[model samples]
Target: MKKIIPYIFLISVVSCQYFEKEVPSEQELMEKQMKEINWKEVDEYPSVADCEAISDETLRKQCFFEFLASTIQQKLSVDTLSVLYPELDTIEVRVTINPDASMQFEPQFPKDTVAYDTIKIDSILRVKLVDFPKVNPAIKRGIPVKTQFVLPVIIKTEK
Candidate 1:
């Protein structure tokens, strides 16, 4: 019985190792791709004022300066998070923007003067793994893993 138990344990350990998923090389590939992405293209936008005009009054007043931050400015100033893991066939990214309410705008400020407001905007990016043919084969075959990246985005408007 002792011998049989030892054999069973040995077999189980070997089988577990055999069944374990291997790490994919997608991390290196993703990092290379991320480094090559055109940051300017991602940051470029038509107008900040137009973007701000669509927000509610509370957001409008609170995020007044943030609403004035152009995509270019944001791209130039904000940091980005990027990661790659195995098992994800496709990455679905969702962006959400939340404005802070503590900020107040002073109407007396000059048009060109950049005013600092207490309002802060939270930008969240949600990433999910999905089944798709375009995903890396190695990643698809490995253990399923998903990753999310969040960034604080300041929306800007035109003068």
Candidate 2:
């Protein structure tokens, strides 16, 4: 009876699954990892030389905008149009900064200001932008990312 009891116990223990947990498949594991990641926001922002000094996120963002504006303003010659088109007050420049820091842009001017030649404006902006310094692009999960900005350049009227 004792030998039979020991044999029964051994059989019961061996038959019972010690580790019942199912091992996840590679595809399942990968899908789970992907779901864990947050894809909406970048971990780091695109930064210029001047903006790098700022530590605060909001302030750094502001500095970045200001830096780009100042750089573009320096190269852009608004005076050329002032004499010909005094009515034009602003130009909205749409810029896309690629992951590699290269830029592409389109300028939008008011339709009412027909006297202002758009080709001339585009040429001037394109040339000036070519000289713009390469900036560090935004990053997400250690990968460089592209970003876009719309900047309104106010035409300074001589007072």
Candidate 3:
């Protein structure tokens, strides 16, 4: 019994390293999780009440943007933009929707654009875009997130 006890203790001591696992540090675990996440992709896009019924992800995003662009076009059509700048056909608007449900709109002009009065166009957009219904912010990993998107608004006027 005494001879067997020493052999058992020797075997247990030599085999203990094989049974142990290297624990990853917190930083390593965080880096691995970040690598698994895609920064450019979102689980859900920011949406208005009208777009909530869409089931498909791609279609929901499309509907949201289209509804916003159409609403913008309609609202701006009645304003003095076309009359003030008849040559301006379309403007790209960058809309930022915050997680807190606040919003902002900024007109995007081309680098070569020097003809239109930017201040007037920006003021017009600000005034006309205030009436949009409350928007549900985008979702990432089930948490509400801010989203920014650009929509092209065409100017149409009938003579």
lDDT of model 1 at position 25: 96
Question: How well is each residue in 20-110 modelled by candidate 1, as lDDT tens digits?
Answer: 8877599888998888865433221222343345546445434433433333234323332221212222212222221211111111223
Weakest 10 consecutive residues of candidate 3 by summed lDDT: 149-158
How many residue pairs of model 1 clash at the backbone?
Answer: 10
Check candidate 3 and list the clashing pairs. none
lDDT at position 11, candidate 1: 94
Decoy 2 TM-score against native: 0.73
Clashing pairs in 2: none
In candidate 3, what are the lDDT values of residues 52-104, reduced to their tens digit? Answer: 99899889889988888888899999999989999888999999999998999
Model 2, 1-159: lDDT tens digits are 988999999988887786567899999999999998877777887888878888998898888888877777766654465556678667789878899888887887777867778988888778766768878898888989987779987666676
By lDDT rank, best first, the candidates go: 3, 2, 1
List lDDT for all candidates, in order.
Answer: 0.32, 0.80, 0.90
User: What would the C-alpha RMSD of candidate 3 be, to one decimal place?
Assistant: 2.3
Per-candidate TM-scores read 0.23, 0.73, 0.87
**TM-score-best of 2 and 3:** 3
**Top model number, lDDT:** 3
Residue 51, candidate 2: Cα error in Å is: 1.4
